[model samples]
Target: MLSAGNPYVLPSVLVAAGAYLAATLLTDASLLVRIGLLAVLAGVVPIVLNRLLGGGSADEWRDDPIEDPGDGGADADESREA
Candidate 1:
């Protein structure tokens, strides 16, 4: 049950950057105001991004299709013993 359509990395980075920008640009705003806006942004960004990104769960990655290649070892390792 692997997923091939959920590319959430970009959306997360974008949302985080947006939140950080929103927090950083409020230089004259009060501390409470800054905290509140940051809090709301932190809370809302993931939820929106999740919905926008198909809302898959950890289970969706259980059976990764790409096989592991043993730490990118050299061809010699293929014949060497442990």
Candidate 2:
């Protein structure tokens, strides 16, 4: 559930700045080289940072335990059969 208010905001901003720096520093390179370098940084930085920071999945809500509706006998009988 990525949002504007996510905690990753600061790290993402830092990564963007670092990527810009790397891109500028390598300005003498060919267009293809620059594009490739930027692509790699764009792909790797967020993943690495997220892994290091233990950022939960974008779809983490799906992994949450769903509350039973407590429909009474139906759930109870099903559990008893198990």
Candidate 3:
């Protein structure tokens, strides 16, 4: 429906780019520390931004659980039986 995968591509890239730039500022920090900053920022910031900004309709973005109909397929043969 919603183009299959990663509807937040642009926001993700922007967040990642910003993370890279911010991580680069820590020139004296160890590689692992810089990597950790990038990992957390790149992974978490985009989703937070999206939720805070209300980037799209709540229905489109929210992950609500679907309710199953009570009938299921049990009624499929009811008319034929009558």
What lDDT would each prediction earn against the true structure? 0.59, 0.62, 0.60
Query: What local lDDT score does residue 10 receive in model 3, on the 0 to 100 scale?
Result: 62
Runs in model 3 deviating more than 4 A are: 1-12, 18-26, 57-82
On the 0 to 100 scale, the lDDT of residue 32 in model 2 is 79
Candidate 3 at residue 81, lDDT? 82
- Give candidate 1 regions above 4 Å deviation: 1-27, 68-82
Instruction: Check candidate 2 and list the clashing pairs.
Output: none
Model 2 lDDT per residue over 1-82, tens place: 2443345656665665676677678666676766666555555655666668877664666666677566875978999999
Tens-digit per-residue lDDT, 1-82, candidate 1: 1223334545644665676677678567776766666555555555566666677755667678676677766665866965
Clashes of each: 0, 0, 0
Flag the better candidate by TM-score, 1 or 2. Answer: 2
RMSD of each: 6.3, 8.3, 7.6
Query: Candidate order by lDDT, highest to lowest?
Result: 2, 3, 1
User: TM-scores, in order shown?
Assistant: 0.40, 0.44, 0.43
Question: Quick one: best TM-score, which candidate?
Answer: 2
Error (Å) of candidate 1 at residue 17 is 4.3
